[model samples]
Target: MGIDLEKGGRIKKRNRTAPKSENPYLLLLVKLYRFLARRTNSSFNKTVLKRLYMSRNNQPPLGLGRLVKLSRKNADKIIVVVGKVLNDERLYHVPKMTVCCLKISDSARARIQKAGGEVLTFDQLALRSPKGSNCMLLRGPKHAREVYKHFAGVAVEGHVKPYVRNKERKLERARGRRPSRGFKRKPKKV
Candidate 1:
C-alpha cells in the first residue's frame, strides 16, 4: 500500500488597494482618481490613486525649503504632492513654481504666492493636466518620524532609543547601562 499525504490549502493574499481614510474630501479625491485611472492610460493617475490609499504615516509632510530645492530645475512644471506642505523658515528665498497638494500651511502658501507662484487644488490640477503632464510629483521622507528612532529588531548598533519615563540620572540608570551596577556591554570595535 502507498502512503497518502495531506495537502494544505492556499492562503489568501491581503488586499492592499483600499484606503483607510474616512474623510469625505479625501474620498472624493479617491473617486476622482479612480475614474481618471480607469479612463486614462496615464501611470501618474494610478500612482496618485495608490498614494491616496496610504496611511497618514506614509503621507509625510513636505517642507517648503526642500520643495524649492527640488523643483528649482522644473520651474515651469506644477508640483503635485499627496501630502501637506509646511513652511520652512530656513529657506530665505522661495522660488516661483506652481504647487498642487492636498494641504498647504498658511505661511507656505503666502511664501509661494509672494514669489509669483500659484497654489492649485487637486480638482484644478485634474482639469489642467488629466495625464499628469507638465507636473512633478514629490514625496517627503517617510522614515523621518520621531517614533522610528525607537524601532527595534534591527542592527541599529545602540542608535535605537529606549522609551524612558524621565531623563533624570536616578531614572533608567541601572544594570546593562552602568558597569558599577553589573556587567556592561563593551563597545563594538570599528
Candidate 2:
C-alpha cells in the first residue's frame, strides 16, 4: 500500500486563500481587496489581491530614490506598492506625485509631503481609481537578500560565497580550494 500524489509529490502553486496575519488593519484591507477582486474585471485588482496574501519577506520595501526614477516617465500616474516606502538619503530632491502604499517611513513621508506630493492608502486609492486606471504598480527586488549571493551552479562556480566561521588564516587556503594540498584544478578545454 502506498500513497500516490496527483502532481508526483511536487506542487508549484500558491494555495493561500487569505493572509496569515491577524492584524485587524491588514485583515480589513484584505477583505476590501477580496470584494474588489471579485466585483471588478480589472486584472490590476486581482494582482493586488494576490500580493496582499504574500508573506512579510515577499513584501520587500521600496526606496524613495529608485521610485523617483521609476515614475520619471509617467509622473502623473499614481505609484502603487504593496510594501513599505523607505527614505533614500541619496535622493536630495523629491518630485511632486501621488503614491499609494501599505507603509511609509517617517522621513519618506515627510519628504514626499514637503515636495507637494500626496500619499494615499489602498482604501483611498480604491475610492479614487476603482479600476486602477492611471496607476503604475511597482515592487522592490525580491532577490536582493544576501543569501542569494551564496547560491551556486546558477552562475560562475568560483563566485559563490562561502560560510566562514573563523577569521584564522590557517582555517582557509586548505584542501580543494588550495593548490598546495592536492592537484590543482584546470579549466576545461574549449
Candidate 3:
C-alpha cells in the first residue's frame, strides 16, 4: 500500500496523564472501581491495557505503529532481527532494540557502536530477555526463525509489504486520451 511514514514519527510518554473525565464507558468503570474501593475502604489497582500480540501470518500486527512509537521513547536497548542481512536503506531509520545485518560493514558497525548499541547475532537476539522488558524486533527476511528463538519478550516493528499498486500504468493510460499536435506536417504538393 502506501508508505508508513508514522513508524518512527513520535515517541511515547512513559507516564501518561489521562483525562480526569474521559470516555463515558471508562468513566463508568472508574466509578465502579471507586465504589468498590469505597465499600471496602481500601484502594485497588486500576486496570491497565498492557501488551497485545498479533499473529505473524500474512498481515502486519495491529497497533504495531503505536508500539514502535512507545519503544523509541522508553526502550533502553534495541535488537534488529533480519531474515538474511541488513542493508544501507534499512539502517537509515534505526529504531532502538534491533538486530539486523543488512550490510554489517565497518562503517555501519561503527555508527551503531557510536550510538551506544549492542550488536548480537541472529541466534543471540532470538534468546528472550527477562520480562518487563522493552525491545523491538525487526523481521526483514524469510530467515526470521534462526533469530526468533532467543527473545522471550519483544515489540515487533514495521508493516508487512502490502500488494503493490501500479500508479505509473494508471497515469500512462490516463495520458493517452489527450491528443498530440504534429509539427512535421508535409507541405501540399503543387
lDDT of 2 by residue, 104-186 (tens): 99999999999999999999999999889999999997867777777775324447677788646466555555688674566
User: Alpha-carbon error at 23 in model 2, in Å?
Assistant: 0.8
lDDT of 1 by residue, 16-129 (tens): 466887899989999999999999999999999989998988999999989989988898999999999999999999888899999999999999999999999998999999
TM-score of each: 0.84, 0.85, 0.29
- On TM-score, the leading prediction is 2
Candidate 1 residue pairs that clash: none
Q: Evaluate all candidate structures by whole-model CA lDDT and list the values in order.
A: 0.88, 0.88, 0.37
Q: Give me the runs in candidate 2 sitting further than 4 Å from their true place.
A: 1-12, 153-158, 183-190
**Which tens-of-lDDT digit does each residue in 82-155 have in candidate 3?**
22222353334544444332225555455556656656652342234322134454443333443443444421
Q: Give Cα distance to truth, residue 53, candidate 3, Å.
A: 20
lDDT value for candidate 1?
Answer: 0.88
